[model samples]
Target: MSSSLEVVIAGGGSPGHVYPGLAIADALRARLPNVSILFAGTGRPLERHLVRAAGYNHMALPAKPAPHNPLEAVRFITDNALGFMAAAWMLREQHTSLVIGLGGYASASTVRAAVGRGIPTVLLEQNATTGRTTKWLSGMVESVCTGFKEVTPYLSPVAEVVHTGTPARPRFLKQYQQWQQQGEVVRRSREPRIVVLGGSGGAQTLNKHMPDVVSRLSEELKDWRVVHQTGEGQLQCTEDRYPSDTSQILTVSYIDELASLLFETDIVVCRAGGTTLAELALAGVPAVVVPFPDASENHQMANAEVYREAGACVVVDEWAAGDRLTDELTSKIRELAADHQRREDMSRAMRGLAHPDAADAIASRCCEILCGTDMRVAA
Candidate 1:
């Protein structure tokens, strides 16, 4: 690859989509000192902040999620057309050599523009099932890199399908090494910590139900420290509900020190987003994954199932409520927290599932394509 290679990494909607692109961009930068990355995304405030904070140029597109209502659907179409135009102009203006779609509606326009211009395009699908945009563009792209092996069979027969696993940020690897160094001292501690993650945007069901679950198991969890990463939307309400006297329960709108949090956590209760799962695997943390039922094609459930099969985590549906939810979740957490060996076993299983070098692997492939190695993925 050229030292001055320029590429557009496109995706948004949530931190799940954006972070992986950032990770890949970082990997590429590390590999090629002069590589330039321009992040293309919808003008989401969070996405904008994340990209700029990471020290990358960002191009905002007029893309939006597909709307259900007929009127809104028309707007979506028009917005995407404008988005395609914007992306085309960016590619030409920036002299981008490659376009990478990170699996979201925002990436669709950029990928289409690149392909239309006969420029190279690659897609990173960070789920067990292919995202709608990725699936639609599969046949036209140079390659489709997947987070799970299950995705390979579902992709276009002609497209190159590479199982690169999800690209976890370098922070996870750094924290994992630190945890390993202090593993004995930390594991020997009888009091276990539990961290609840509601994804980047937060999960409403988790926000509404977790406080009660904690309250009901307060006695059992008395010796345990619990930290809940409530999304910004539920921050104030969720915080007010916790008892002021107990230092055992802490609630925050977001998690800034996620790697450290995961390093100390014995059990994680979170949504089954690809990026979240990858971090958990890297940290070797046991989890109770609650799949978002409305997620496209119920992909989260499929993602969780992969971990459950490998003994990495337990899966609980979001719809489970009251006693059904509380009883099952409490039992699962209690069993793991009480039994050090069992948590350790789950941790080993999780580490086995992780691909710590996935970002580098994808970056290497991108370099191969850019440097004019056969663009077609090897069979």
Candidate 2:
């Protein structure tokens, strides 16, 4: 890979999408010192801050929000067409050798423009099932990358699909090492420290279920120290309902120190987002995953199933609620706590499922696709 080469990355809106882009961009620059990255996305606050923090040249385009109604979809399409034109202009201006679409407003335009100009294009689908955008654009791209093993069936036959795991923040490896050194700190009760999150934005489903969760936490949970990461708009409600001094609960809208908490945590209850799954695998924290039911193609459930198969996590359907949910968590945590070997086995199995060098793998593959070099994926 040539250091002087330029790569344009499209798709970066939320933390779910933006962080992975940053991870890959960092790896690409490290491997190819002369390589440069340009991120093009809508004016998402998360995208703006993260991209600049990564020190990449970014071009922000105005984009329409995700649409639910037919009229909204039409408006979004019309607005996106204009965004695409701006992205095309950026693509031409940057003279990118490789275009990477990460399945967001920006990627749809930038990647398409690169393809239209006969430039090599690569797309990364960070889910067990391809989304509407990825599924449609996959046929036009040079290759498609994924994090899970279950996506092969959905990929286009003509598309060169690579199972390149999405890279997690390097900090998790450090957290895992520290936790292993500390060993297990036994609590008086059987309940484990359960952390709940719904990607960066948090989930209304998870938030709504929080009241039930707090009120019905198993008796064993009394001794457990619980930390819940409820996304914005749900924090105040979660805090008000579940007082920390009253219960073993610490609820926050977000945690900047996620790496530290992940290391200390014994169990996680979260939406089965690709980035979250990757982080959990790296942290070696067994989880009870509740996938976002409406996620495109139900990929979150598919992702959860993959980990569950490896004995890394348990999947609880969104439909299962109230006492059913509480009982499930209690039973699962006790099962793990009662069996030391089970916990150890799960930790090792989960670690095996992680690819810490996923960013490096993606960067290497992108280089291989563009420069005809052997891209190295770190083990």
Candidate 3:
């Protein structure tokens, strides 16, 4: 008889992968009271600290992205494969029941090992396109879930794809509640408020330009509030580096209340990470998406283009992020703020794109699969 009573999830190093993985784990636990959850990650701050703080056990492994050079590729594989072997060994000994790959180097080792063991597995892809790590391991898993149905055409026909929507931090929902309580006074107020996020570790591109942009705001726009999330280390730099007054700007390494910021926001200028896009959609907020240019396969750019085509966001190429970006943003903000009908239409479009129940859906599906419930039953 199978003895594993635990679900093992592999993802870490970046908040992009870690946050969703945590949400899935959190959801699974809420549904399945009997099963335990474990994580395999590279021990990045968000992964290790946040997961642990959430009261879950984390099994750290050494894994890095596969190399571009043929010579470095061998070294990378050897390193990651060994880490995989270790994670597999851990799973083997722990009596793991289900294995999940959330896509990233942290999962590289665990996924390889789990598939070889014939473990029932679920892999989640959050972008409109699958990453190379996920694509390579797609067929090995029993099912592949995606955030957007749009990613379906890119995957292998043999891979069973389900549209699960993207799993976001619980704060997204919590913040929505607060927004409802604030009523029309704050909601309909003409004060222009912009929230800017630089993604997990912070966007170097945003860090450099945001300071300048904050500096250039005119006295007429003095009442405008800019909230900038620059990730951890940049908080101090943001605090002292920029000269903007507290009333005009608030800069932090991270904001625990991200959802609150969303509801209060008139506009969002953020990296086009899948989760950010999903959150913007869920919150019905218009945005300016500046994708990370060096993102693998230019996936961020692709993600941004999807929303742009839908008229949900404006795309700003990373190459042109400084100086005039402030002018460009000011122009767009005024345009979006003045054209009430246009903003409303785009907000409705954004709301249409949200999957508020995605986290619950993925968690429930994985639990059902792990609990010996047959997939033949409808979801």
Q: In candidate 2, which residue ranges exceed 4 Å CA deviation?
A: 1-4, 176-192, 320-341, 374-379
lDDT of 2 by residue, 1-379 (tens): 3455778888877777777888888887776777888888876776788789778877887577568799899988888888878877877777778888877555677777788888888888888787666666788888888888678777776778888887777577567666567655632124556677776688776666655565665464666677777787778876776644566777788888887777667777788988898988888787878888877678888898989999898788876654476566555656664565776677777778887777877888887876677555333
TM-score for each model: 0.93, 0.88, 0.89
Instruction: Using lDDT, give the best candidate's number.
Output: 1
Clashing pairs in 1: none
lDDT of 1 by residue, 239-258 (tens): 77766778999898899889
Sort all candidates by lDDT, best to worst.
1, 3, 2
**TM-score winner, 1 or 3:** 1
Off by over 4 Å in 3: 1-4, 68-75, 177-186, 239-241, 244-246, 320-327, 374-379
Report the C-alpha displacement of residue 337, candidate 2, in angstroms.
5.7
Relative to the true structure, how large is the alpha-carbon lDDT of every model? 0.84, 0.76, 0.77
If both were scored by lDDT, which would come out higher, candidate 1 or candidate 2? 1
Q: Predictions ranked by TM-score, top down?
A: 1, 3, 2
